[model samples]
Target: MVKDLVCTLKSARKREICCSRTTRAIIIDEPTPGLKSIFHIIILDQRSGKAEVQYQHDYVGISTCIGFNANPVINFSGVFGTNAFALGTDVAFDTASGNLAKYNAGLSFSTADLIAFLTLNDKFDTLIASYYHTVSPLTSIVVGAELTHSFSTNENTLTIGTQHALDPLTVVKARVNNFGKASALIQHEWRPKSLFTISAEVDTRAIEKSAKVGLALALKS
Candidate 1:
């Protein structure tokens, strides 16, 4: 459970306060046996000029979520089965318009060594699939593709990527897509929870073009 409260001044004399609360209840314990269920609820005050309530539940092999907002929009999503094999759908409806704002569905399968997903999106006009595999303890690879069809155009894309850990503190990653663009990055943890990274990208098809480079550093306290 969590709660947040904020105070703000609307003017020289007017003041406003907003509160938000979140609660979680375990309906069934994991150790209790056959089926386990959990419920979560969230309430938001008028501080944001909107009152909202959200609820989520996970029971047996099914997970469900629902949200209601001040905009009069309702969002719902559910997934069935475990991570090893599951199917899910997400959709949003606008009460004002009485129409579906968005909808998508996906299926996923996972194992100790690999995981894969297939999804239909954009009202079923687009399809995407991805695969990931643990090549070794220190290396892994991923591949993904997307296809979209519309009244005027059809688009397709594919990408492949891999990551390898050089040591406990250093790692490197590289990826390339069918669009002739390639990128690689290396990151090293210089100190506890601190890291430095360098990355570069180039257009394989047009070598004459200038390459892009980037550097980043993060420090944690």
Candidate 2:
């Protein structure tokens, strides 16, 4: 099978030319027995002086993730210098009968002020936990929550979701959150490596800037 390659060019809203960025990603599957990985790299304009690299790997029981950022390329001080390193990992366990449990945590911090930041923000890290229980051959329930806290901000969210298989090729998911948010997703697979998905989210409490709708199509060869 041939994997798809993707490239994207992005820029900031304020200075499009100075901060222009090009990002490339390559994904490989089954290069070896039970191993797959993705390599990603991004480059800011040669004139702008910035770069980053990220790698992701997955295997039978666990996956590893880590990345680094170099903004301004030269400055080694303050928040920009302190927050240059990004690291995290996620792990999941599956039972023979299709039950699943997962845990993930990650943090971004400055290399220079690691000790100071770690001491003060021990409780202000990002954490996620989830569990899925198979109710029937065609249905399952999932419950998950995420907490993010740092000097800059804090957020806590809880989610409950359900998946139902309507038929061999059609599946649907409905979810709700403690923050008065609700969403639904429908997926249909037409054939091998071809998928269609429709998703929408609405804020019941009508919070500002809290609604989203999306449609996506995927084709693989």
Candidate 3:
């Protein structure tokens, strides 16, 4: 699993100080076979806002994250096993409101050549499934779909997309949903770390509508 944390601090006064500190400890070191756990604590103080504390824990097959400033929120996520088939769930609880704010679960199967995943998100109101396959050493494909149900509107929407790699440095992707909107993009790496991309979107139901086009370039130093 990969986790990213970002902190932003803004202050109008030049004399204000913004700082952060992180502490980590191994709480359990192989208490039993194949079992270990650690704790991480992060403290951030911004000049313009209150101090915030974040906690994270990781075990052999489980992980947890928690953050609180005034309203505390706790999150727990865990993967069951260390095999090709994996199951995981992410749940968030709001301590101030005494309710579960978010919950999501997923099951995935992976192999050397293929990966498949099915997930329930948005408090179980949304369902998503995806498949990825490596056709050859230099070519691969991916397909994914998302279905969402609105409780208030009593409506449903589905979107599906696929991506294909033409070569080591070029790729094309397209997606369309139950709606009339269709979009496609092609990206190519012109240099070792530079990329150019062209994308277009059109409403298929409205043949006379003008298509939207976009271009992007990225470079790395």
Candidate 4:
């Protein structure tokens, strides 16, 4: 795929102008052999002041294949916190993201199970975080005081939007809800590392007033 090929180069599939020294990429909705709904992303150097290309994956999208029963009825008859969706097996994504908020744009599962599971349970990552059209961000996903977030129960719902309140934590379990659209149950994911060193160093003075703008451009589509 073009994203894959672009990721292989110094340039990230995010598609950026030449004036900057940073590049980012994301692994779109392709369930590679051993991979689940994962987005392989790399930041030239945003979080850490050092010049390094950090790679990560988060399970935000996935749908059942023809053979598998999408979103199997998860008889949460087990425990309160137990995930209602069987979520097939945990498939690895290139990145991992979550928060313990009440609702969240959830894992890549099936629409049926997602709603059913939500009815059976509560305490999800802030239900319906954001909506999006594509997986691989053509540009960035971040905004001022707001950062772009992507979520999916599966292919049924893949969204990209900005969230005012941001929490950087991993969500353990969630109960699918019926009120909103259904999504895929994302399994585990694996982040593909770059063979070369992905590095960056953004100076406050260089970005100045545009630092926040640059961040917004760097994360949101």
Highest TM-score model number: 1
Better model by TM-score, 2 or 3? 3
Tell me each candidate's TM-score: 0.73, 0.40, 0.68, 0.17
- The Cα error of candidate 1 at residue 126, in Å, is 2.4
Error of 3 at 27 (Å): 7.3
lDDT at residue 103 of model 3 (Cα atoms): 96
Q: Give the range of the ten consecutive residues with the poorest summed lDDT in model 1.
A: 51-60
**Alpha-carbon lDDT, every model:** 0.66, 0.52, 0.69, 0.26
* Residues 105-210 of candidate 4: C-alpha lDDT, one tens digit per residue: 2322233212222221133312333322222233322321112222333323333223121122211111222223212221221222211111222233444432
What tens-digit string does per-residue lDDT give for candidate 3 at 1-221?
32433353333311212233433233444445655444334443443333223322232355555554577677777676455787888888998999999999999888887778888888987776766666554566776666666665667777788888898899999998788788999999999899999999998988577589999999997
The TM-score of predicted model 1 comes to: 0.73
lDDT of 4 at 44: 40
Backbone clashes in each candidate structure, one number apiece?
A: 0, 2, 0, 54
Regions more than 4 Å wrong, model 2: 1-124, 138-155, 207-211
Candidate scoring better on TM-score of 1 and 2 = 1
TM-score of 3: 0.68
Candidate 1 has an lDDT of 0.66
Residue-wise lDDT of candidate 2 within 69-154, one digit each (tens)? Answer: 33222211112122354444343333333432344444354433121112122332544434445556534333333333344456
Q: Show the lowest summed lDDT stretch of 10 residues, model 4.
A: 72-81
Total colliding residue pairs, candidate 1: 0
The all-Cα superposition gives candidate 1 an RMSD in Å to the true structure of 9.2
Stronger candidate by lDDT (1 vs 3): 3
